[model samples]
Target: MAETLSNLFQQFLLYMQSGGFVMWPLLVLTIILWYAIGYRFHTLKRGSKKSVRVLIRKYLTGKRQKTKGLIDRAIVDAIEAVNGKCDGKRGREIIEDLFFPYYQDLKRYRKVISTIVMVAPLIGLLGTVIGMIETFDSLASMALFTQGGGIAAGISQALFTTQLGLVVAVPGLIMGRMLDNKANMMELELEQIKDILCAEKGLDNEI
Candidate 1:
């Protein structure tokens, strides 16, 4: 498997080299974008397992007779202790205050991902233009006016850059989109819990 992987990487390098200098930077950017996407995905996945629900339940159901203990537990549990206690508005307000920063961070992650997605194609196009220019220049210099040939080589380089760009963008875009959706879902869940808490406190009529 290692040998096969190494061979594949060697082949990819050869292909990239064949595409010419314009493709090099675009390829590098794609690699960086992929790394960022993978990093964020893994980090979020790990954090998601913190069991926010269980902590909330424990805090809510714990004995309230000990006033000091109750407050201490509430403080300790913080967002994790979200029991359905406040009115809808108050609950949402509390939750919003607590999670706004986190939600914004998640949003920022998606923005970075999307920026890479958009930039990759444009970079590829630049590479294509560069490749075409080089090809034309080569033909002019070589005095190949009779054949109307040797055009394919340049075109192949152009296509190669575009193909690599899309290959990088597609998966990054898909994963970024999925990540956004998951973040939204998590936000909504937080909101829903807040709503439930607020309803318990008679704050939100809808709740």
Candidate 2:
């Protein structure tokens, strides 16, 4: 498996070289894109074993101050808000205020990932433009074309970069969306936990 993986990387490097200078930027973006994806996956995977509701209940009923992970932090905030018979609506607001920051934090790099997804193809297209210019320059010496048609080589390089751009982008975009969806689910779960805490804290159910 290691040998196969090494061979694949070698092949990819060859292709990148064929793509020219634009490939370097695309390469950088691709690296960032995958790094962001991997970070989100690792974060979500190593998240709380228990649900937000369970964590909230435990925190409220018991005495645990410090917390780790996204959901746990939100639950801690909500639990801390349970100041002896507080107004329900106000308690919910407090939870919301605390929860929103962490919710945003959980989705760290959401915009960065999206920007990379959108920009990668454009960069590839830029490569295509550059390739065309190079091809056109080569053609200026039209006398050489008849003897050794290098146009095919130019065209191949142009298309390869454009193709690679889309190839990198499609997966990144899809994975970004999936991560966004998961983040939305987590938001909903945190909200539910907030609601439960609010109910226990005060009489008004408006929150």
Q: Stretches of candidate 1 above 4 Å error?
A: 1-10, 43-59, 62-94, 142-153, 201-207
Candidate 1, residues 90-194, lDDT tens digits: the string is 655665566555556555557778888998888888778866876787677874332323466577778888887788788888988888787676666555555
Model 1: colliding residue pairs:
86-198, 87-198, 88-198
lDDT for each residue of candidate 2 in 78-188, tens digit (9 for 90 to 100): 676666534644666666776777676668888889999999999999888877776776788663342223565567668988998998899998999988888888878
Model 2's alpha-carbon lDDT is 0.75
Cα error of candidate 1 at position 123, Å: 1.2
Top model number, lDDT: 2
Quote the positional error of residue 152 for candidate 1 in Å: 6.2
- Roughly what TM-score does model 1 have, to 2 decimal places? 0.66
Full-model lDDT for every candidate: 0.62, 0.75
